[model samples]
Target: MIGTLDKAKLKERYDICIVGSGPSGMTLAAELAYSGLKIAMIESGSFKRSSLAEELKEVQSEKLPIKANSRERVVGGASSTWGGLSALLDPADLAHWPLSFDELLPYLKAAAKYHFPSLETFQNPSGTGWKFKNLADKLFVAVRPPFNFTSLVNIFNRKGVDLYTEATVAKLVSQNGRIKKVLCRSVDGQGFEVSAEIFILACGGIENSRLLLVSGLGNEYDQVGRYFMNHPKGYAGRLHLSKPLPVNNYYLPRVVGGRMVYAGLRLEEELQKEKGLLNACVQFEPDLGIFQKYAFAIWRRMPGFSTKVLTIFLPRTLRARWFADMEPRAENRVILSDKLDRFGSPLPKVVYDLSERDKATLEELFSQLRSGVERLELGKLTGTAADVLKVVKDDASHHLGGTRMGLSPQESVVNTECRVHSSENLYVVGGSVFPSAGCASPTMTMVALSIRLAEHVKSKLASKPRRTFKNQTSRTSSQKILIIGAGNRVRGDVLPVLESLPGFEITGIFARHASSLFGAHRSYDVRTMESLSVENLKGARFLYVSVPRETLAQVLSDLPGASSLEVIIDTPVLPAVKKYAHKFKRIHVAEDSVFLPWLDGLKGREVKEIECSQSVFRYHGMALVKAFGPINYGYRLGNKLYLKAGNTKVKIIEPRDYASGKLKIDGQEPDLTAIIAELIPEERGLLGEIKSTDTIVSKMGELKRVGLRRLLLAASRGEETWSLEEGLNDVRIDWLLHKVWIYLSI
Candidate 1:
């Protein structure tokens, strides 16, 4: 199933088509192998590197030089030269991520299981006598043999996955909001096409953006190759210790659990936050060769003192090297070059510029490190700022961003699920979707996110029956509904759907002030009410509550026909209201968070497992039983919901912000939302009822001109646009809020 051959040798079609055989693509292929979906992975190079394949990597750069050799076109991709340094992004560094640390932790652990199996203990050094704010701590780096596709070729051969090497993806052809086919070329000038239900661009950062730009796929927001970032490394300074300290293997490479691992040092998250500094780490290498080169210069400056100092502390001295985060800048980008490769594909041009803030961060980091080392008496630093600058290098080969993920198409190239904003079935994987690059190597994180993406793709492929949308005819015996909210969701979102439904009659709308109901139609019966009364609930059969969380309890308590009327409450419900929800004839709370539709789609299907967001944890204990019926379930230690009902076993996780919003059944995610909207009586014809763009414009327009201008500027600069009505409306902010609530709740 794994071979390097012509493009004509590939299968006619597959369930999933992945471009690139890098770590991200390989990890995803492995995860989806046994999920009953056929996978096709395309790599431009064969098992080994070649001159022709390497020529494709040649790129033009502006300020920072592009390391053409950093990326290998062979089956292993960059792993050919990767240092194998593996570490989770610091919690502080993850502030820019859509998911939380806890949500991504499981995937990181999964990736670590494969790469850094024998993890050495990471502990802070004690009794260093360094009384400084920032100190060096332990960090784990994987020194195992680099992982290449050939290593996993046998496993892939057995699974439902096929790897095709020497296949260069030329262009992605999309039709009707979905990727229809991928046109590819072999090295020998053979051309072919591969079709798939879902297409994933797992290519490296530069290529991913380049392909999208070339094909005009996901550039609707003009953000395809924007917000480029990378880690810049340099020689920080030198340290000469008074005496040899008890340094552990964490600071040096050593065998642990039968694997070679080394540790480095990073500034604590708290200190970085306090100083408003970028994340950075330093490693010390005892280099006598470097000392010998610098000895002559030191001897010329001070002959006798230099000789005595060098003799006493020659072995104890260490050369310090630092790696720091680069801020994402729109100007620092990847664009299509005028030059073309052998295949007639345009080459990439990378424009990178180091900001003044970056230099200041490096200066502060070294100054603090030196102060700490000298104060602790652990070491005496002996290097000028000029010496540090002189040894600085431009490239780390870690390209990030250009396909940044966010909740909206206007601000990012991809959605939180890694799906390209413009194309429904097109997804981008790798460091390209990273909003910001932390100080750590991106390979581990790339693998982790890819694993998560595999589960999502599997689930999507499994739930196929419910993916289609069908128009429904109106019924004669319709129910009377009343919306009780003072937000634009009533007029812009709920009202249109209600009016379009055949049997649903809008009785009345209630709000505190007439202006609060600004978007409502004049034909509708809109009324101002100070408080809920029996008259308001007169003839309504169903009540839709979309009020603020604080007012939910009051609205629930004031309900007049609680015994007969069915109530649909928006999610993140108040605990007190949930406790008394059973009082109604029938109650259904809307878990509007992304994964809920997947659960709704599985209503009549035979499901093996169901995983959902834990945003509804308050109602899960009772709501799940009420929804699924007679299920035996228990709570796992990691806040996972484990349930077994009949032949089905379910596990649910409340994801951290940056995690994927997907529901899985039997390790597969089906288009349950579409199914639920089609099959379910209550949800029929109401899927995608909210128009996010319209609601966002309306809510944003409510702000003063000056405030709106400020937000527009921030959004343009790739910063968070914290709106007050974020969750109250149907804007992308709801998706963002759902992801970041764990941080905001604190």
Candidate 2:
């Protein structure tokens, strides 16, 4: 099922755990559907692009110009933002690979079928067969609509896999030279472990190396994070033809089988082999007028309104855009930077540069392409070889070759099967495993490798007897609960906490506005209800209410009085519980502060005194009073209130507004994630003082709020909980605080 890792409890183990949900990971998972091997696909990013994901992927690029958004950190990886340019690697690109072109052709065809608009769209056009004057056609195909792999959400259910988004794998734990488990943490800082029989790293080219370096794995012979590559792309030169010789044949996009096909020119593979040159491809685009160029730029930034404007405008000249593959150099690599991300993992430092041969290849390809156009009497090219040499270089967003696959450990990180050479049950996929990159888009080739890996794994598993796994039906079965609100509190906290636990199915949601109802349609399935009907609430034993005061009153008054019904209302709406207590069988006012990690240390302990200083006296004082009770006397000195309890001293310091961005830790600007990490040691210290698990301390406030799980479990068993009397007493303390405040002001 598709659920976020922060809110979903993953199974303890799986047959395989893939660490990325990119094109490669998604393809591999889909290919293994119905294989009877349970899978867990963990994605560091959420379904959308998030700031945390962006920050986590921060890279220190030394030479290659890698933009901040060059590599997408989302469910579909870079495919989410890509233009859907699809093509296969040239056969010469596989020269350094352990496997040959013929062996990989089937998977390539399968990938093309899966990604292309149609199978026929991938076939080359007839006649000279795209070969003329020692130049061949490099096909570029674009689907009618881009193929975003995240649309494969249903595969989770069909494949019996659990897709966990917003979960970042921290380290791979190895035992006896094999990966044993992975320690993962949600972006919100909830840490957990996932163990599996096999582990695959498909977290992109740079990330594959960074993870290996961080985990101290697969670096034998110091080849784990070396030989990084990206297609160096730029406008090499401008070609001014003698005549406008059918520019449509080169510049215009051809509509073929529901796809836009562009035939780019490249050096013949045989010629490249003969000259010992790198793979290079160049496509021609007609230069636009000043107004048209400006319009195009604006349209690119704001795509909704520029298409018609561009169609009305026309171009003036044609130019050559070059994309050349870089030679894999041992010095070009991704290493762990000393700088840490919010998760405390080292950032990837990329030391990448194009080789002299790389530049010469581009120059040579441009010269040959210009020579052919002139030989064909198309036009006399204007831009010279000097212009080609000065081509402004930028990364093509095609990150490849770190942890490259090959035949030996000394030269590669993975073998022909994409398995790590030194470690069994560990495999690598994606462009990271490409021993050589062609001057084509890498996504299609990566998909092929992923499919190949799936077949290899399937054969490896076929020989071994299948192991029986424990059924998880009992944990996720049909105990129903209906949510009564669709506000931030309900969507952000209530639904996630309740959904994380077992034995509860959210049946439906109730909201006044259609927008609110639409907002509640999260990863899981939940029908939106018009009103609280008998049919909607048929099996629901509990109702979670977190609306405003008026809405709570209306909802509580309208509730059906079944003895099985229980109400868990927010603490602010305690008066609603008092008014409607008799209508429901049980009521629990959720005061999450009582379950906070700091407060958990005070539970069941005698407090001698309490020192409180803060605004929001009702909320703050109630938390302290509820946790440590039976105050004999209270004294106010200055701004602080001192309370006498039994013997233990309780100090509630002036709470800092962490969200206001004013708090600082160790002279550094306040970052919520960093502050949370810093507080873990102190939270652990608090746990040491109390009888509590460290897991709760690890999640800090999130799990503390999730302590609502206990109340729900108690309600399920018809056990005792914070009763109406105690809830009223808690409110009375707030009432007393109000009276005291009025008196003091007067």
Candidate 3:
């Protein structure tokens, strides 16, 4: 349902919360809706453009020129001002990516299909029609109307999806390494909160980095706002043909299969790689105006010459425009300014610098292009290198590379899954996550990555055990289970699955209200805390506690003979609960992050060494233990933890060091799958060595004090650890301790 931000009417919780209703955010919302997960999308603007909202987009640029209409803050984002040009990133451009072209091809194809449903083919011819060795001929450029959310109005209205317009997320609230809530405010300055299981920042390139910086989120590697890039474009020259040549509609936008398509010139990928030159493309348009009219008048005076001129030479008076790639440089960056917006958020200060390589690349490319045209006798290029430089503009409105993707947190803001390095559930999607921007319009690539991200989210949701209704006419003597806390997780994640099983039935539920239990079976009795007694717990074979951590101990203590029953806690047990460990015969704490399926292979394989390079704050320790086995001995070397059992060795490197390219195992680069494998088995044994009141306080304090980025920097420099009182408060430390216990127990 599309509505204004009304905290009173909004649901208290959602499965996913997406910030910014741009192409990437909307595409992800549509893709994830198929899975039936409740989604909430928050946009800063409404359907129509607003001066107030647009004012927030104001940015100060240094060196590079900022386009006045570069970004839109409305419902559709930049799509509102986009000139739909679809093209894929060159394979050579993705050399640094962990994902290969083959891996990304399906998503790219899907994105193409989404944009052009009737697209028959995308293949371009090998060489330009002009016979020149270096001249690039047929370049694939698909033209379609800019993507607008209005086109997906019906999709946005889908059930379980809530889109809040004019609601801007100002900051993210983190607790125990998870984003628990988002503080949002309207343009009118009304404030509210939206909580969700997973949070995604799809608020364009500039805003993406800006929000993270203000919230002190994913900047662990100091790479969040760096490597800013844009496709530098300018007038190359004019083409004067030696002979009248027939120019086809391929050079111009023409309707084909009910969609607009155009073909331009791209330096072949092989040629660019061979020459060690950057990717660049050029397009030609007939130089129309007074010159064309006068030429036509002169040509009409000679019938024979006029026929040739009308057929070919008229189309030869073409203007050339060049688009070239910009190398990713650290100096080109976006940072927060001292000035604040109306909402009190810092305005982004973009510092863009065109490198010497960029200038040389353009000069070399146009020179080659001029030679190619002249050599083929196709045309004579007019305009010197100086003219090209003078007319060039850095405002393609293609803002890219702020929250780039890399293998580790130190190298980039997000991981391969697009999840933030320090936070497990936080993700960022859009051009901001691009590690490098090739000389192609970013819309196509952004859409493809959004599709991939949607799939990943869906898979993660599917991996969690949720409720599924089943019909059963007969009931037999089965195990009776008592459940506490009638919240979303119990009702949505536990009840349905439990009811579907033939051998189990929910005997009782302890919650504030019975009506809150969704699809509640009549046979099950619901009771409040005061009314509950030992008689209700008698004969119940299994007791499941899904209550808040604070009340868990009280709830467990209230039940008599609790030691006789099997207890399963939804959350990780606290260290304080160890004193009551003897009360329950078998205590099981659910650890959702652990995937048992990943351990399908390697039963007796002789594994050498395992290296886990993950964010220390968001590490999956228990899952590691279950995957590997028992650890015999372990020690810490600086920020890395090393554990060994017989022949296999496990190393847990700090996330920043991993991203800085410091962690290596057996001379091999860090692999997440392999590292987690080694790190998991040794988790249980190593847990005791690393577990301490001071250590836990120190880590959490570091996370809060400097944020993940600065915390990593301090750890790398071997800075002094914070004291318990100076560290995270007792409540947060208690939460951290419980998480550690969960990992150790698992």
Highest-scoring model, lDDT: 2
True lDDT of residue 638, candidate 2: 38
TM-score of each: 0.58, 0.61, 0.59
TM-score of 3: 0.59
lDDT of 1: 0.63
Q: Give the 10-residue window scoring lowest on summed lDDT in candidate 2.
A: 657-666
Give the per-residue lDDT of model 2 (tens digit) for 1-746: 56666423565568889999888998888776547677899899986788888888889888777777788889978878777778777778878888887888788766753454333555653212223587888878776456677655545643247788888998999999989999998877878888888999999988999999999999989998899999877775666655443423534354443356667877888888888898878886656545545743553344333322323332336667778778889999998889998878899888898788887787778788778877776665677666765764677888888899888999999998999999999999998998888787878788889989999898878865554433322357666788876655665466545644457767767754322121111333233345568766667787887777656777777777767777787765556556767887777766665544344444675544444323223443454455565544443433444444445443333442212212111222223243234444423222111212223223333444444555566666777656656666656654554456321111
Runs in model 1 deviating more than 4 A are: 4-8, 117-131, 136-138, 290-314, 464-746
Residue pairs clashing in model 3 are 128-137, 220-709, 563-583, 611-675, 624-680, 624-681, 625-680, 628-681
Q: Which sections of candidate 2 miss by over 4 Å?
A: 6-8, 117-120, 126-132, 245-248, 291-316, 463-746
**lDDT by residue (tens digit), candidate 3, 1-746:** 66677867575688899999888887787677546677889999877788888787889888887786888988878887676667667676788566787887788776643452222345632222455566554444443334454344333433457788889888999988899989999778999899999999999989899999998988867888988888877766888777644444455434444244455666666767787766666776567656755753453233334433444545657778777677888888899999998889899988997787776667776787787877777758898877776666758888998888888877788888889999989999999888877777788778888989999888877865433323231264356777887654564445544533445667778864332232222223345656667876777766777887777777777666665666666434554544554776655554332332223333465557756565333233323332455545455555666655446776666553322323233545433334234533212211111212222222222112112122222222334322112121222322433444211212
Q: State model 3's lDDT.
A: 0.64
Which one is best on TM-score? 2
